[model samples]
Target: MIQITNLHKSYKTGSNSLHVLKGINFSVKEGELVSIMGSSGSGKSTLLNILGMLDEADTGSYVLDGVTIKNLNEKQAARYRNKFLGFIFQSFNLISYKSALDNVALPLYYQGMARGERMDRAMAYLEKVGLADWSGHLPNQLSGGQKQRVAIARALASDPKVLLADEPTGALDTKTSYEVMDLIQQINDEGRTILVVTHENDIAHMTKRIVNLKDGLIIEDTPVQQVRALENV
Candidate 1:
């Protein structure tokens, strides 16, 4: 459902140009669960940002679910993101002042969903993530795993075409990380497309396919024997 070709990205630092992604190419089909693995300077984040439409490539093409993604005005990009993309970050990215339910409902609010319906939809997603009982709790009131569950609920509330999770389990303990990954696998089992950006080898193995990045290029791409996270959980 996503395609990129010969992608290139560079950033200017003082007088030097730092190339983050060079000649990157990959495609993700619908219903696929993939991981992009890389180190700190490996350009995985840059690739995810381009896919997430949070940033643009300096060159090459990107097409998402049949729509060409280039030169989009801020309004257009935001509309596309709300309509077709869901994001999960390692930091949870929840508003501290908002309750778990409100945080999940935020995207629908931006879509102009009515108060009652958006809330109902958000609650359903929270239920899916096994956090319905904690809907009234604020972020600080929840444990790290609970907060990530809330974040996952918020991501799913939009029913977007693809879920882009950046270091989804980075901040969790081993057991909690596996639990979160188990939840992700369950989502993928239901045929949702997902791309996880992570550097952890164990985390990457949980995905159906792993794409390794080094020095801004895809150095390896292979399908692995999927390590079921549920087994660990």
Candidate 2:
């Protein structure tokens, strides 16, 4: 579960400050699948950074899974991020030289997991994402969707409390995007909290809830019938 109240953030440009998030209040419950929809300069990225702990809000409170997130040193912040959040980026963010299996195991290695245990866990996640057979393939060797699947497996290998995906389906074709979304939905069904940041309307619709942002404000937050991606694909 996550909660942020009256969040405000700003950045300086020369002498002027551009406010990114203003008096925003939002929360995502455990096991919920939510999407944040916004245009360029809509502050969705700022919000995501704050939520992902990549950047802290200038003011307000963020609590993740019962831990208050504020004023932490980089070391502390990194620890919390590694322990509680998994990230899937649009570009997949895989190392070009690392094989899919090693890519998935990277986080666990950072966490100081033993080699044998981490590899086992990584392989399990690869299988979970239907990429077991491609475990030895490098990112360059896989197709766009398969690369994304490898990213998803990497995210899950940490077994974090929440998955924060930024434009998860943005890089793939419609069919591939739906396939990835289907995997995400299945993950949510198993009780992992997920928050997707996307600009596509159809992508937002795939989630159970949509939070619309504009000019650094949450203009709309609504729950709707979930669009089953597997059915559509």
The models' CA-based lDDT, in order, is 0.95, 0.94
Q: What is the lDDT of residue 202 in candidate 2?
A: 88
RMSD, every candidate, angstroms = 0.7, 0.7
| Local lDDT at 51 for model 2 | 90
**Candidate 2 CA-lDDT value:** 0.94
lDDT tens digits by residue: candidate 1, 23-56: 9989999999999998899999889999988899
Query: Candidate 2 residues 122-148, lDDT tens each?
Result: 999999999899999989999999999
Error of 1 at 102 (Å): 0.5
